[model samples]
Target chain A: MGFDGDDTLWHNESIFSMTQERFRTILGGIDAAEVDRRLLEAERRNLGLFGYGIKGFVLSMIETAIEVTGGEVDARDIQTLIDCGKSMLAHPVELLDGVAETVEYLANSHRLVLITKGDLFDQESKIARSGLADLFDRIEIVSEKDPETYRRVLARHDIEPERFLMVGNSVRSDILPVLEIGGQAVHVPYHITWAHEHVEPPAEGYRRIEGMAELTGVIAAL
Target chain B: MGFDGDDTLWHNESIFSMTQERFRTILGGIDAAEVDRRLLEAERRNLGLFGYGIKGFVLSMIETAIEVTGGEVDARDIQTLIDCGKSMLAHPVELLDGVAETVEYLANSHRLVLITKGDLFDQESKIARSGLADLFDRIEIVSEKDPETYRRVLARHDIEPERFLMVGNSVRSDILPVLEIGGQAVHVPYHITWAHEHVEPPAEGYRRIEGMAELTGVIAAL
Candidate 1:
């Protein structure tokens, strides 16, 4: 079994944040919180239009900025918004409750691997900081945690797809990909998720948990 | 003017880290320092192969594990390294010194925007946390900050590249693209960099600063 570090185990976001805040600050004096609420609503409404990813967030922030600012904003604000988009690429990684114990218990039963994506050095440094580096049998820091990552990690451990189960927060990168390879999947939802990783209707054989606290219970059941 | 978030204002690495203490704990009666030195040597030597992303660092860790264990490490040990990688993806945003000041100062005279790429919501939240969000006029989250993002952002700004200077750490995304559009580029190196953002044969017109702390001096001179 495995997990995706960002979102699943900890908070992770893309880089749309900087611009969003800049917009709020520049167009302050109004109810920016309500504006933010509306923008978030617009984002959810336009999820289908933009899909998830950097491009979608960029356009949405611009749209939201323009909508809330009532076209009083300028190219400078849009430019700053774009800049914020780039700077806002991640969420702070705080481990979901019980991540450690679940992994510890699962370690005795199934092979546990941690698969994730993003800048390599940043990822590695975080692992060292987390102080839970001794849990897994294999760690794969892939460019993208797709089916390829899952298959390769499983293959390295000589784990069959049928025998393996992927426990993660993302249905897009983690669960879906593993399921594609005929492996089982367990999803543990984080408080927030990247819009891009949203799966409209989750596929079959996918097990979900509200938080990592319930992870061991589900995995033990599996 | 705009700033690059990763590797400019912040220290970001895509590689998972192996601490010296962990090495000593794993391999008893061995020269752990030498092990560290050898690992560094391998990383420096293989930096070319990995090229600064998750794929590269994962390969580095795998190679390091094989070398230190002499190909005899158990699944648990291998997983330990793997977990280190999973742990790596969860690092918090570590902003570089003077970056906040630079953004704040620039916000006064110039139109500031955030031009960056990566995940969407993750980026937005980090900007809000950074406390410098009020300074910029806009934030743009992008998927890939290639010429396209520059082109779109520039067109929106109604400012030619000659009039707009893009300040960032990545040669590929920040400097080269700005230069490609006839804009000025100020490169402020961060403590660490993502692998894929690395550029070879530094292009002309790209001014380099030792770090973000010196950014103000260089910008004032410009």
Candidate 2:
């Protein structure tokens, strides 16, 4: 079994938040909430325009700032946007529930791998900070995650897709790729899922669990 | 420019947080620091597998939990994961530094919009929670973000891409798409950025800033 990280096993992304009060204060007489709504729209627009990458998101914010300020924008506002963008690269990796336990339980019977992606250095640094290494039999990081990646991984391990069980929260990265390659996969929903990975009406041969805690049973069923 | 609401603007995400102190407790006998190191590696691997969405993040936690506990996992652990996951999803929206002040200041001249991608109900609720809805001249939500989407939006607004600016913390969503269309864009660094949006070689015509407060200068420079 393999697991995905970031928002899953850890509480990450604490840095990206914006206070509603701050947004309200900026828009002045305008409703702060309305500002949030507009910002959300802008993000959707940017995401549609760019896909799931970091650079475009930062630009969207700069664009939002200019638009919100009605083009009377000044250095102070730009600086605010700039500073946020610089460090936006770091994610505070906090752990999730049953993440430790479930992995351990599964480790008893399965060969586990930790697969993730990022700047490489950042990811490695986070793992070093996490204090829970040495559990997986293997760990791999790759730029692209899809059926091809899953197939290659399985082939490398000499493990049949049916003999391999993939557990994750996203249909995009975990379930879909693994399933696409004829591997069994399980899904555990996390909080605040991104829109892209959302599977409408679910997919075939896919199972859902509320969280990591339910993994043992799911694994048993598998 | 657009912004990423959940983590970029404010403090969000708490899925992996629950296990920190607990991990310290359980693995006290081991090199806690070392354990964290290995765990962090596993986490990086997980992110690549899961991407930026919430579901895979949660799964990473469970996998981490299982790895750390050495098969001593239990119900309390699982409960913790789910509870934390829900918290991450339902947690209050927070804003980054100077965002409120900057937004208000920018509102004096610019046309601001919120662009985000997420679940409909969740995104709408967050907009309400963020309290910045009225700050924007418009709000748009879409299922995808790509270069084509950016082109269409600019075309619909009858705004020349060169004259238009996209500001955001995400290189993938905000900066690149606008730049791809020959639009001007700015990069504002947020403290903590989501992993899925990471990009490289920043797009052309990208101007960088430290925070939204810098917008005043940036707008003037333009």
Candidate 3:
């Protein structure tokens, strides 16, 4: 069994949402939608250059701040943006409701691997703080969670896609990719999703569960 | 045999040095020594928070700029810093002299694994662009190259430290840690080294080669 980090087993997207809100306030007077759009544009432009993570997001925010403000952004505001990133890095990893119990329950009978994508230190720190790291048989912090990445990971661990099952919150990142490579996946929607991770659900291929509470039942039924 | 990326296989610190010089010019009038001191301090301070890579380095640079300028650093300068980071990310991966030939030569007879430590995406992109990726039997991009990390990697790959050999430029990262775990290592010094990666050479137990040109000779003798 493979578990996706971020919004899958913890409160992740909500933190990003909160940070974006804070960013909106920092760039006050600008239309929130415009701020968001410009920030997202900077993020997309930088995605290939900076990749993903709070550090990249903060950098993009700084870039967008300068762009939106016509290069008149306060240095202190830039400092504020940097501070936001630091705090986000130091943000406590809060496991979602019933996550600890469900993960612990499943670990008893299965080899659970935590496969996450993000900044290495940030992800590792979160895993350490998540307090549930011990339940995982193996932990993979990847650069991205695409089909090729999943294929490489599964091959490395000597597992066939047919026997593998992935659980996560992002359909774009966690579900579609796994199913594309012949693996079973369960989609457990989170209340908040990043714009980059938003994608239409596949018409038919995977199971959808309300949350971690239904994970074990789905796994058993599989 | 395990090889370190960055300075080991290609040019890395030189790019950082050039960027730091540009930073100095941007913050002109500040004592270059003071700028270097403050930037290094910021980097060390944020190391735990930002980890390693151009993103974190750029963040530290921006933070230090704010500090040196007393929160009055120009927003355009901040954008310049961001641009510096983007260019660094887009910078070409230039392999050190003889690295390609040496790595390829060894790969024919030895299981060469590339073990590097840094941001996941940055390191992955570097490896891909290095053109030597196909020669590596396995590639491990870690957050830190501590003794415990080396041990974990070796164990995962079923490599006993006594039989494992590591080649890299940083003694702190690639040599001492591997030596501490009973692994044999060869130090191939780069022309420049990052301050964070500098450490006194181990008193004994590892061979020192001036560069990749001498790598295969040392390996054969080992």
Candidates sorted on lDDT, descending: 3, 1, 2
lDDT of each: 0.63, 0.60, 0.92
* TM-scores for every predicted model: 0.41, 0.44, 0.98
Local accuracy of candidate 2 as per-residue lDDT tens digits, A1-222: 777766566654334444323434555655666666666666676453233434334444545555666654443443344334434544456688878888877888889977764333345556656665577777665444688878877776677888888777677888877877778877777765654456753556877888788889877775
Candidate 1 — which residues are off by over 4 angstroms?
A13-23, A27-92, B1-222
Q: Write the per-residue lDDT of candidate 1 for residues A1-222, one digit (tens) a residue.
A: 776777666555522344566667866766877767767876776553333433345555655655665655554555454445444433344666787777777778766677766544455545655655678766666555668767767876788899887777777887888888999888877656654457764756788778777877776676
| Winner of 2 and 3 under TM-score | 3
lDDT string for model 2 (B111-138, tens) is 7766654433345556767777777655
Q: lDDT winner between 1 and 2, please give it.
A: 1
Error of 2 at A146 (Å): 2.6
RMSD of each: 22.9, 21.7, 1.0
Q: Give lDDT: candidate 1, residue A41.
A: 78
Q: What is the lDDT of residue B81 in candidate 2?
A: 48
Error of 2 at A212 (Å): 1.2
Which residue runs does candidate 3 get wrong by more than 4 Å? none
Return the interface RMSD of the candidates, in order shown, one decimal each. Answer: 21.7, 20.6, 0.7
